[model samples]
Target: MNIVVGITGGIAAYKAVGVIRAFVLLGHDVHVVATDAALRFVGRPTLEAISRNPVHTDLYEGVAQVRHVAIGQAADLIVVAPATASSIAKLAIGLADDLLGTTILASSAPVVVAPAMHTEMWVNAATAANVATLQSRGIRVVGPGTGQLTGSDAGVGRMVEPDEIVAAALAALRPRDLSGRRVLVTAGGTREPIDPVRYIGNRSSGRQGVAIAGAAALRGATVELIGANLEVSPPPGVRLTEVSSAAELAAAAATSAASADIIIMAAAVADYRPEITTQSKIKKETQGDRLRIDLVKNPDILAGLASTRHRGQVIVGFAAETEPDDSALLALGRSKIVRKGADYLVLNRVGWTEGFAVPDNRVLVIDLAGDIVMEASGSKLSVADRILDLLA
Candidate 1:
């Protein structure tokens, strides 16, 4: 695969080197293209040394070979990392003043952007509009996650990690691993209605499951994402089925898994629910000293999927255990994998410090055969890729 790495002006410009290294490690041919401002932060010599190709930073430097058109036409994927607000605006408006912009304009290949800027710039009406415009035209945007910025400010404008950006870029360029493959993935924490306005739910934010669906889609799989009331939106190119209760999730999973080649039970479905839901808000009665609500076990979606899995189909389950001893937790996960008849089980420790609702993650992929293919630690997207690689 021929990958073009486009670097724009931003403090995160240095991170683009990691993205290029990931692709190179994966055995893909890589070339670097930098904007004038990007050069200021990351030297041309450094990029050329890493990419093993001449850095292209000029629109007119190589006019005889029409370098911009040539490079763009040869690219399998165009990734713009540390995509500053300025560059995004330029791309949104079809500007071609430099090599990067001109090459982007000429490329027919899939494009992925990793935006990095201040919180205010990201939330600015112009930037938001530009992002919307780009998405409407089928361009992919990875992240500018919420975290500490260059200075005292802290918000959503921090650039996503290089590994994550690389994963998204690879997903864009690779043969859809799920192409012609039907996959059903459950996402988010299921809500067990207790009353008109309240419900029992877990701490799941659904980021991992959404990443799984997005990764699968990139691999050419037809994905049905059975989502609960998630805080975030599902990635583009997925069929989303919304559900609230555990029962609803189970029903959706069952129906979707009927024709699926792979079924991943990633949702943090509630283990129990109230025996009954009140039509109206329950008042705090002054007459009563205390009150209690009876609870009942909810249907086990993972167990059901495992039990009914077709002969050739693959069923993957997830176990989020909070245990002090990592070895014991892994052992328990292995037992669950066998008991549930799942082909693979992803085990991760969840607590106040790590796992659950966080951008980064660490996981162990234990197969039914008791073999560990990957013991990786990184972003959720990287973890998803490791799982997919094992499946492949």
Candidate 2:
């Protein structure tokens, strides 16, 4: 794959190196098209080193070979990582004053832009209009996610992380095998509330589940994501339902499962919840640090869905265990799959450091016959695609 990465003048331009590096590591032929201002923010040498290609900035430098247009013409995909407001305006109006602009204008490939700017500039009516116009012309906009910007100012207009940008860029080039398929995904760790201020929850950051949802959407699935206190945002094009407790997740999943062709229960649901949830915070002084709250088991959402699923629905369950022995882990996974009666069970060891909040994972897929169907180890996104391959 030939990918042209366009970097604009923005603080987030520094992060574009990660995007370029991700593409290079994915075995794509990467070329950097940086604006002069972008060179100032992120050094040309750095971009060249990461992309494994010389960075192109000047439109006039390549007039003889027609490099400006040729680069874009040869591109399978064009990505603008830190697309500043100024560049967005230029792109909206078809301005080709520089190499980045000319390359974008010359490309027939799918163009993806990850916008970066301050909240004020992003929310401005003119900027919004320009963005809308670009989208109207079929430009794929990744995100200007809400977060910290330059200085203390923060809101919408922060460039999203590099992995997300790379994921979106690559997804555009993948075959949409999941088109028209409805995928139901549950993410994060459900919190069982004991009081208004405190709850019992696992260490799930929702990276794996969120990655699955993102990958599913990228494969052109109509995705419904039920997230229980997710640490990350739902991928672009996914219908998101926010829930905090096991009961809420169960209810949401049950409601959404009927129409889904694939159901993946990835959320680390709490096995028990407080029998009585206090309206006010349970003070340490009043409780003497030894408050014993009665507990009750939450519903087995995966089992229920698997048991009652309509014909042809592929139901997948997840088990995050601390079992250290490999054989024991496989045994546990196999037994759990049989008990839950899910079509497949995904098993992974989650200790303090390896899983839960990490970006990478190692997992085994257990079939109903106690066979290991698939084993994956890599970044969550890659693993997610491997898991989806079963349904795909």
The candidate scoring highest on lDDT is: 2
Error of 1 at 346 (Å): 0.7
lDDT of 2 at 71: 95
* Model 1 residue 204 distance off true place after TM-score fit, in angstroms: 0.5
Query: Which residue pairs show collisions in model 2?
Result: none
lDDT of 1 by residue, 311-366 (tens): 89998899899986978987898788888888889998999978887877898888
lDDT of 2 by residue, 18-88 (tens): 99987775456899999888988999989988988988988888788999899989999999989999999
- For each candidate, give its TM-score against the true structure: 0.63, 0.70
Question: Runs in model 2 with CA error above 4 Å?
Answer: 1-4, 8-37, 40-168
Mark the 10 consecutive residues where model 2 has the least summed lDDT: 20-29
Candidate 2 Cα RMSD after full superposition onto the native fold (Å) = 7.4
lDDT of 1: 0.87
